[model samples]
Structure formats: C-alpha cells, structure tokens
Target chain A: MQRTTMDLWVGLFVVMGVIALMILSLKVGNLNVYNPSQSYVISGNFENIGGLKVRAPVKSAGVVVGRVTDIQFSTQTYDAVVTMSMDSRFLFPKDTFASILTSGLLGEQYIGLAAGGDEAMLKDGDKIMKTNSAMVLEELIGRFLFNKASEDDSL
Target chain B: MLLPRRLVSGIQHIGHRVIEGVWRLGVASRFFILVLLKSGTSLRRFNLVIRELYFTGVLSLIIIVVSGLFVGMVLGLQGYETLQKYGSESAVGTLVALSLVRELGPVVAALLFASRAGSAITAEIGLMKATEQLAAMGMMAVDPIARVVAPRFWSGVISMPFLAAIFSVMGVFGGYLVTVVFIGVDEGSYWSQMQSAVDFRFDIMNGFIKSCYFGVAVTAIAVFEGYDAPPTAEGVSGATTRTVVTSSLVILGLDFILTAFMFRGVS
Candidate 1:
C-alpha cells in the first residue's frame, strides 16, 4: 500500500511536469512557427540588413509564412546573406520581391515579401533575386541634411 | 619589527585560507564524481529516487506555484505601466512571456529551489550525519554515498527542470489573467504578439538548459555541504544556510555566463 501510494504520487508529479512542458512548447513558445520538416530553405542577399536578425518573421500580405533561419555577412560582396525557412504551405513566385521592413515606428524588423506575377514558384535553396535592404533612419536623415545643404549652395 | 611580523602573519593567514578553499573545492569535485558513479544503484532501486523526488519536488510545488503567480502578476502590472507610456499596451503579453521564458523563469525557480529544496536536502543529510546514521550504514557494509547521497542528488537533477517548467507555465498563465482578464488588453493581440515573439528553440530551450545547470549546481552544493558538515546541531544549521547562499550565488553567476554565450547576437 505504501509503495503504491508513493509510486502513484510520483507518477502524477512526472505527468504534471510533462504537461507543463507541452504547454510551454505549444501555446507559449509556438512550436509550429518553424518546423524544419514542413519547411523549405531560401536565401536573400541585401546590402544593408540594419537590425534584422535570425528568427525574424517573414510575412506576406501581413501574414507570417516563414522565419529567418540564419544571417551571414558576405565579406567579398559586402552583402548581408539572409537564409529563411519558409513554410511549404505558402508558395511564392520566382520573381517575388523581398524587403526588410519594421512593424511600427520602432518595433521589430521583419521580411516582407511581395509576390510577382510569375508562373514558376520558388523552391528550396532558391536565392531571391529582387531584394531591398533595410531603411536606416540615420542614413535617411543624413541624406536629407546633405540635400538641404546642396540646395542652399545652389541658392 | 613587531609591525613587520604582524604583516607577515596576516599574509600567511590569507594564504592558508586560499589553500583551504582550493582543497575543499577539489574534494567537492571528487565527491560529485563518486556520486555519479554510484548513481547506478539509485536507478536500479528506482523508488529511492522517487521518494526523494516526492520530498523535494512534489513538496516544493505549492511555494513554487504561488510565488510564480505573484511574480507574474507583479510583472504584468509593471510591464503594463511602462508599455502604456509608449501607447503599446498590447505588447504586454510579449513582454510578460518573453521575460518569463528567457530570464525570470529558470532564474527565479532556481533561486526558490535553492532556498526551499536545497536547504532541505542539506539539513536532512546533515542531520543524518549528526545522528551517526551514515556511520551506521558504513559499518553495515553499505556505501553512504550510494545509499543516501546519490538518490537525493539524482532526484534533484530530475526534479529541477520540471519545477522550473511548471513555474514558467504558471507565471505565463498569471500574466495572462492579469493583462487580458483584468486590465482588458485585447486578447487576440496578447496571444498573437506573444506567439510571434517567443520562439521555442531560442527562448524556451535556452531557459530549459539554464534550469538544468542550476539543478546540477544547487544539488551538488547541497549534498557536498551536508556530507562535509561537522556532525553537530550548529554544523547542520550552518550547512543548510551555506547551501542556500552558495547555490544562489552560483546560480546567478552561471546564469550570467550562460546568457552571454546563448544570447550574444540573437537578440
């Protein structure tokens, strides 16, 4: 009787722990966001990635269809090489345009994909040809100031 | 001449303490290895580990759950107050879940485990030593390390990750209750924003790994202190206190190093 009770309680404790882990992985952590088994890899090259990071969302029409898997800096071309794991459920054409974009005024940056009218769909390991780099706020302001100075000189 | 002699003595005392500390650390490492080797017996006799699990893991659930809930509630209140200033109150879920999963969950759970279960293990083993029960076992041809120490150590190792997981889950639930149920934050945004932000591999797995490290550190310290106790009432009390203090410091230090390595460029 004593042994069974101990076993029963210990079993219950272990079960609860497992349930908690499941909740963490499913509801809280969103495990389905990037299941490698159900996804395909694609890469994009950009001149300036700014603050874009690995695991950043890749959205199409404001809905996340993929995630940034890896980000590497190409020393030869000075381009940010971004690798994304796109969900197989969502397919984009070969001429899709990929751009780094921010959500709000100062929120996390994500990759936005605008599909092009192409008959062929992109596959795994395909490199996105059309890409736009992140818009750096400081660089834009600097350019605006330089334009103003140039206009004053002209005047 | 007298002042010089006193200074020399001070230097000698400092050297002595450093050597003692180094020697004690070596002994602890040896003890940990011995416990690992003898852990086979604990597994063969599974109920031993289960019994200790009940004592340490199951018993500590109430304190862990209540504290987790309260901590989450406090975080919700504070996070909403700060986030609302930026007119981004909807991101409260993201803030609560991210912080809980990444930093607070494993760290706070380990701290609580150190105080509640770590101290208990030390006191139990220390008391056993005080009562000469360990010596009694040795006379009966039983290895005290295998019989008493290994079971407790393995139990701690097994239980810690679970305890930390439960703590994180409760904390997230508590935050949800506060932010969505009470404060009237949009439930859709609360969950969706959090789902987008919290990644399973990076945030959740890292937190789990952190808790596992804490488990090993806390239990190792607890068992070592208890085994090294002076076999007296004061010694047991002091060992219990040291178990908590040393475990807390180690947990925090290890957390810092692990966070630096794990979250270096991913943020």
Candidate 2:
C-alpha cells in the first residue's frame, strides 16, 4: 500500500509536469492553437523583408490574427512575395496595410496589419495591395552618407 | 625565482602529469562503457534502483521548485523593466519563456541537482566504502559495481529530466504570477506573444535533450568519484566536494558545446 501510494504521487507529479510542458509549448510558445474554421489565404509583395521567417506572427494593432505561411521571390518583379493564412474570425477590408515590423530594436520581425476604410472586405485568395517592407538601418545610414558626400562634392 | 634544476623537473613533471591524466581518462571511458553494459544486463538490482530513485529524485524536488520559482520571478521583473523602455513591454513573456526553455531551465536545474543530489550520492557511496559495507557485500558474492553504483547512477539519470520539467513548470507559474497578477502586464499578450515567438522543437525539446545528456554526465562523474575515493572519512568528504565542483564545471562546458551544436543553423 505504501509503494502504491508512492507510485500514485509519482504518477501525479509526472502528469503535472507533462501538463506544464503542454502549457509552455501551446499557450506560451503558441505551437498549435488550432482555429476550428478554415482560414483564408492572402499574399503581399515587399522589396525587402529583412529577417522575416515563415510562421512569424501576423498581427493587427498588436493582436495576432494570422501567420506568415510562405515566402517566395517573384521572378518577374524581383520582389519578395509573402503568403499568409488568416483566421476566419478576423476579417479585414480590401485596402488593409501589411507592414513588416520588428518587435524591438534588435528583435524578431513580424507583420503588422492596419485596417483601411474600404467598403468591401477581403476574400480568400485576395491580395493585400499595399505592403511596406522592413526598415533597414544600415541602408538608411549608407544613403545618408552618400547624400552627404554628394552635397560636399557639389559645394 | 626558482632553482634551475627544480624548475626543469617541475615543468617535466607537469607535462608528464598531463599525459598521464589523458591516459587515465581513456581508461575511465572504457570502464564507464563496461558499467553501462552491466547496468543493462543486471536485473537483481532493480529494487535497489527504485529505492535510490526515491532518495535522489523525490527528495530533491523541494530545492528544484523553490529555485525555479525565484529565478522565474527575477526574470519577469527584469525583463519587464528592460522591454518597457522600448515600448515593447508585451515581449517580456517571450523573453522569459525563451530564456527558461532554451538555456536557464536545464542549466540551473542541473546545477542545483548536482549540488544537492550528486554530492549526496557520492557521500552515501563513499561512506559505505569507508564503513567496509561494500567489502562485506563483495564477500556475499555480490558485485558492488552492479549492486550499488549502477543503480544510483541510473536513478540520477532518470530523475534529472523529471526534476527539470517540474522546475520549468514552477518557473513559468512564477513568471505568470509576477507579470500578470503583480505587474499588470496584459495576460493575453503575455501568453500569446510568447507562444508565437518560441519554437517547440528547437527551444523546448532541445532543452530537454540537453538535460538528459547533463544527467548522464553528472551521475557518471558522481559514481566514478565515489568509487575511486580513498576509503576514509576525510576521503568521503573530499569526494563529495569534488562531485559538486567537477559536475558543475562539466555541466557548464557541455551546455556550451550543446548550444553551439544545436543552434548552429539558427543564427
């Protein structure tokens, strides 16, 4: 009976540990919180995605409503095309803005969605027409240097 | 400042000692392999293994939980302060979760386990040897390595992951209590943002695998030290001290190697 009691507590401890791990992975890590309804797909084009990865959060006003599903290079346009799977519950207008945003100065990149006042809502396979690429700090600095050098040359 | 003859001999002796230590390590590896084989082959010591597991694992749970909670609380408070400056205070969840899951959880848990349980295992065995209990068992036609050492080693290995898991859970709860209830960070963002940021396979499972390897290495060192210690009271105490120190250094070194290898493609 004592051995059985020990085994029961051990089993309970193991269960609790497993439960905690699931919470960490699912609730905390956001591994698989499935939406029962089917999701809608859309695509966007950006000149520079910076460090965006597939499975990155797609959020609206800091609330996550979707995930980046795929990233591809469009051969004709030489632009990075990003596909996303948005939850069925959250619907956006046709002219919603998709911007690649970093959480902090040196943090992971995610997509930020800002709603537009369009009469028509976006449908499945719709394109998010206006997309802003990630801001590149080095490129901005280089441009500033180049402009400064040109101004000096003109003088 | 030293005499030339003595200094020359000292340099030569150091060189000789390094080579001898390397050779001894190789022999220990072979002996470890034999011990591993014996552990798997033996069935008579199964009950002993269970008893050791209770002592090593069940007994060690208190220390793991308390430390894990404190560490989580500290991470939450500090992470919140840093991230709030950038107006990305919501990312505190991601910071705490990732740090615990990837690095701190396994490493800290292992360190605590080594100091608490590993040293204890070494002392217990060393005391048995000092008291000549091992010799008495040997006269009874029992293999001391199989009967005593292997069970304790195996128990230590088995206990580590469970203990680490418990520590991580307690840590997350501690983080939650601080961030959500005490600090007034948005609860939804705390959880959702963290989930979105942390990868289950790369972060969490890799930590678990790291803990498992740490378990094996620490227990092996503890058992080996106890078995090789001088059979005296001073010897047992010395061996216990060596167990904690050696296991800590080894754990830190292994954590670096594992992190380098596991996260190679990531950055």
Candidate 3:
C-alpha cells in the first residue's frame, strides 16, 4: 500500500512536470496564438527566400510586429510568395515595401517592412506592391570577383 | 611463406568466428521477439512490466530532473559567455533550447536510465536464470520469454519517451531560471527568443522518436544478455557488465543513424 501511494505520487509529479514544461514552452517559445477573425494576412513576393523560413519574425523599422505564416511559389512568375500575419494593432500602409533582410553576417533571414506615410492602410488579402527580395550573398561575391578579374584582364 | 600462411589462417578463423557470432545474435533476436509477443496476454507479466517501468522510468524522474536543471544552467552560462562576445547575448535562449531539444535532453536521459534500469534488469534476470527459477518455470509449461522478457521490453518502450520529455522540459526551465534570474535577461526577450528559435517542426517529434529507439535498444540488449546468463554468480556479473556496455554502444550508434536519416535533407 505504501509503495502504491509512493508510485501514485511519483506519477503525479512526473505528469505535472511534463505539463509545466509544455506550458513553459508555449509561454516562452511564443507559439502563435491564432484568432482567425482578428488577424490580417498580407503577401510579399521575393525572388529568393534565402533562409527566410516560416515563423521567422516580421519586423517594421526594427520592431517585430508579426510573423511569416506561410511561403509558397507563384507558379506563373516562378517567384516566392511569403504570407505574413501582422498583429491587428499595427496597420500597414499599402505602399509599405517588404524586404527580406538578414539580421547579421551569418544570421537567419526575416521580413522587414519600411512603413510609408500613407493614409490608406493595407487590408486583409492585399499584397505589398513594392518588395525587395533576398540579396544572394554568393551572387554579390561572384560580382566582386568578376569585376576584379576583368580589371586584372584589362591590366 | 610460413608466416604469410599463418596470418591468412588467422584472418580466416576470425572471419568464421564473426559469422558464427552474427548467426547466434540473429537467432537470439528472433527468439526474443517471439517471447515478447507471447508474454503480452499474461496479467502477471503485464503487471510486472508495468511495475518495472514505474520503477525504472518513473522513479528515475528526480535524477533526470536534477541533471536536466544543471545541464540547462551550464549550457546557458556557456552560451551566454560566447554570445556576449558578439554582443548577441539574446541568442542564448535559442542556443539552449535547440541544444536541449535536439541532442542533450534525449541522450542524457537515456544514458541515465540505461545505467539505472539496464543494470537492474540485467542482475534481476541473470539471478533468476542462475538460480534455476527460469528452468523451473520452463518445466511447469511456462515460457520464460513470455513471462520475463516481454514486460521489460514494453516497459522500456513506454518509459523512455516519457523520461526524455521530462528531461527536456526540466533542462529548458533550468536554462530559463539562470538566464532570467541570474544573468539578468529580460523575461519577455528571453522567452521570445526561445519561441522564435524553437519550431515544433524542427525539434519536438525527433527527440521523442530518438528516445523510443533508445529505450528499445537498452531493454532488448539487457534482457538478451540476462537470458543468455551462465549458471554461476561470476557469469551473472559478466552478463550485467556486457548488458550495460552493449546497450550503451547500440543506443549511441542508433542515435547517430537516426540523426543522419532525420537531418539528411537539412544539412
């Protein structure tokens, strides 16, 4: 009987510990708490996503205001379309240009919005018209090397 | 010419031994699986296995939790020191969470359980076999595999994932406590960084899957060695040692294989 009670207590503690960890994960991990009715989705087109994964933060002027919810390729244009769900409080203007920006030299990619001072706010299902796609680091390096090689050839 | 011939003969002898060992292992594995399946219907066996899991997996929770806490703290401290060099101390949460969820948590919990549960199973089964209790059961129309081996296998299969989960959670909290309280990371930023760093798609399911495999390897090897015990005290001791060593190696090897398979596309 004593062993049984001890077992029960241990089981309870283990269950509670698991629950607490999961709760902490939810709380700390900042998993999306979706309110379908209130949230607005806006899409941005990018030539290359680079490391712009889903759930990467969407920051406006260096302050994170939303997250990247989905990424799909436009079959016709052969470009990536990233869907961002912004908090209802921060209304984006239609002219706001979304750029795929890297946090640092070797850091992960995130969507950065440069908000424009416009009267009209972007509604759900609207596309951000002007977009700056991900800058391919390798391409830049290639261009620099190519220019250097051409200069050497000229010499 | 004589030396070359002797060396060739030696190599051939080793090859033959290797094949014989592999054949023996194959037969043992089949027998083990059959015994496991047959034992499932016996209420006494079922109860014994459940009790073993409770003792082995559930009771080991305190040790897993304490170890997890220290692991998280150490990771956080080390990660923070390095990140601070780059003025990116906020990334520590990401570092800790990713490390704990991806590798440390499952591996540590498994090793801990292996030492505790693996040793116990080996000794208990080996002692039973050594004392002719196993033979007595066989005489009474009772199958030892069905009665003994199955419960340990199932217990391990069930308990490992639960223990791994517990380890991961505790480790995360340990990191959080150190970072938030000791290191002076703001509660909001610390948590936000962890959230953004850990994607459910990336870490959670893989960790659980790895733990399940570890459990299976640990239990199977331990029980196999126990069943193969010679009828002597020294033989039981040797079986216990082999059970621990073999199970640990198999667990690590399987972990590497699983990681390679899971991360094949990513890296």
Candidate 4:
C-alpha cells in the first residue's frame, strides 16, 4: 500500500508538471489557437507571396493588426489571393494599398498595409484594389551582380 | 610471388569479413524489429511499459526542468551579449526558441534520461541475466525478450517525447523569466517575438521526431547490451558502461543527421 501510494503521488506530480509546462509554453510563446474576436477578413491579390504562408502576420504602420488566414490562387485571374484578418478597430480606407514586405534582410514575408485617406472604411471581405507582390530578393541580387560583372567586362 | 600472393589473400579475407559483419548486422536489425512487433501486442507488457514510462519519463521531470532553466538562462545571457553587439538584443527570444526546439531540448532530455533511467534499465536487465533469472524464464516457456525487452523499448519510446515536451516548455519559460523578469525586456515584445519566430507545427514536429528517434536508439542499445552481457558480474558492469556511452554517441549522431535533413535549405 505504501509503495502504491508513493507511485500514485509520483504519477500525479508528473501529470501536473507536464500540464504546468504546457501552460507556460502557451502563455509565454503566445500560441493562439483561437482567433481573436475583434478581427475581420481583408483580401489582397498578389503575383507572388514569396515564402509567406497562412497565419503570417499582416502589419500596418509597423504594428501587427491582423494575420494572413488563407492563401489561394484565383482561377480566373491566376493571381495569388491572400486573406488577412485585421482588427476591426483599425479602420482602413477602401483605397489602402497592401504590399508584401520582408521583415528584415533574412526575415519572413509579411503583408504591409499602407492606410489611405479616403473616407470609406474597408468592410469585411472587401478586397484591396492596390497590391504590391513580394519582391524576389534573389532576382534583384542577381540583376545587381550581373550588372556589376557586365560593367567590369566593358571596362 | 608467395609474399605477394599472401598479401592479396589477406586483403581478400578482410573484405570477406567486412561483408559478413554487414550481413550479420542487417539480419540482427530485422530480427530485432520482428521480435519487438511480436512482443508489443502483449497487453500485460504494454501496461508494464506505461508504468515504466511514468517512472522513467515522469520521474525525471524535476531534473529536466531545472536543467532546462539553467540552459535557457545561459543561452539568453550569451545570446544577449552577442546580439547586443549588433544591436539586435530583441532577437534573443528567436534565438533561444530555435536552439531549444531544434537542438537543446531533445538532447538535454535524452542525456538526462540516459543518466537517470537508462543506467537503471541496464543494471536491472543485466542483473536479471547474470542471476540466471532470464534462463529460468526461458525454461518455463516465457519469452524474456517479449516480457522484458519489449516493455523497456515501449516505455523508452513513450517517455522520451513526454520528457522532450516538458524540456521545451521549461526551457522557454526559463528564457522568458530571464529576459522579461530579470532583464526587463518588455513582456509584450518578448512574447510577440517568440510567437512570430516559431511556427507551432514545425517546431513541435521537429522536437517530437527527434525525441522518438532518441528513444528508440537509447532503449535498443541499452537492452541489446544487457541481453548480450557476458556471464560475469564484471561483464554486466562493462555492458552498463557501454550502453551509456554508445547511446549518447548514437543520439548525438542521429540528432545531427535529423537537423541537417530537417533544415536542409532553411539555414
């Protein structure tokens, strides 16, 4: 009986430890499985999203107002459609332009929204007309390097 | 002509021995898997394995937690120092999370498990074999491999992931405590950075996969050595030592291979 009780205590401690650790991870890591209440969906059309995937953050004025919830290709236009969920409180004018921006020199891509001064606020499911797709860094780098090489060759 | 012929024959013999060893290793691995599968179906053994997992994995939580805390603190302090030079101290969260998930958590937990439960398992099986208890079971028509080895393997498998998860969470908390509580990093920024830095699916999957592989390697080496232990007490002790050393090396090697494959293009 003593051994059994000891075993029971040990078992309980292990379970509680695991639970506590999991709670800490969720709290500190800020892993959000449930969507926030004050968010509405906004869509953007892009030619390329680069490495951006679903649930990527959407930043406006350098603050994360929402996240990319879905990415799909439009059948008719063959353009990549990225759906972002933004905070309802941050009203975006209908003329707001969205661009996919890299976070840093080697960082992941995020959707950056530039707010426009139009009086009309963007409603849920509204599409942003102006969109700038992800700038392919390798392409730009290659162009620069090749141009430098050609210039050296000419000289 | 005789000397040259002898040298050629010696080389040919060595080649034949190498092939034979490789063939034996292949057959041994196949037999090992077949035995595990056959014995894994026993309900009693499964229950025992679960019980052992609770003891091995759950009991080691305190050590893992404490070690994780220190590891996180050291990582944060060092990472902060380096990143501060570059004016990117805020990336401490990303660095800690990535390192803990990709490397430290699994390796630390595995090493801890090896030291704590692994030695105990080797000794227990070795003692059983040395005392002729295993032979008694065999004479009584009880398969020792099914009863003993399978349970240990399953227990190791189940416990490793649990331990790794515990290690990861504690490591993160430790990082948070040092960065936010001690260093006065903004709580919001720290958490936000961690959130943005780690994708839950990828990090968790990486940790789980590494732990599972570690589990199998550790248990297999320990049990194999124990079963194949020489008859003397000295042999049992030698097997125990070999188990720890071999398991640690294999775990480290497999970790390198897994990390290379998992992050092939990313880094």
Highest lDDT: which candidate?
A: 1
DockQ, prediction 3: 0.28
Task: Give the candidates in order of lDDT, highest first.
Answer: 1, 2, 3, 4
Tens digit per residue, CA lDDT, model 4, A1-155: 12555467546755864674465346544456323477888898898888887767788888778878888999989999999888787889999999999876666688999998899999998999999888987988999999999999999
Model 3 misplaced stretches (Cα beyond 4 Å) = A1-3, A13-17, A28-45, A48-97, A104-106, A113-129, A135-155, B1-5, B42-46
- Tell me how each candidate scores on DockQ against the true complex: 0.78, 0.37, 0.28, 0.23
Residue by residue across A11-104, what tens digits does model 2's lDDT show?
A: 5656756776776667666557535256999999999999998778798988888888889999999999999999888999999999999876
**lDDT at position B229, candidate 2:** 78
Q: Which candidate leads in DockQ? A: 1
Residues A1-155, candidate 3: write the lDDT tens digits.
22576467546755765674475447544445422336788898888888888778798877767778889999988999999988787898779988999998778899999988888999988998899888997999999999999999999
Per-prediction TM-score to the true structure, in the order listed: 0.94, 0.78, 0.79, 0.74
Across all models, the iRMS values in order are: 0.9, 2.5, 3.4, 3.9
Worst 10 residues of 2 chain B by lDDT: B40-49
lDDT assessment of candidate 2:
0.85
Poorest 10 consecutive residues by lDDT, candidate 4 chain B: B38-47
Give the CA lDDT, 0 to 100, for residue A78 in model 1: 86
Q: Tell me the tens digit of each residue's lDDT in model 1 across A1-155.
A: 25667777888888988999899899987786656578999999998999998889999999889999899999988899999999999999999999999998779999999999999999999999999999998999999999999999999
**Total colliding residue pairs, candidate 4:** 0
Q: Can you write out model 3's per-residue Cα lDDT over B98-192, one digit (the tens) per residue?
A: 88887887788888888888888888889999998999999999888777777777777777877877788788788888988998977776777
The stretch of ten residues in a row with the least summed lDDT in candidate 1 chain B is B1-10
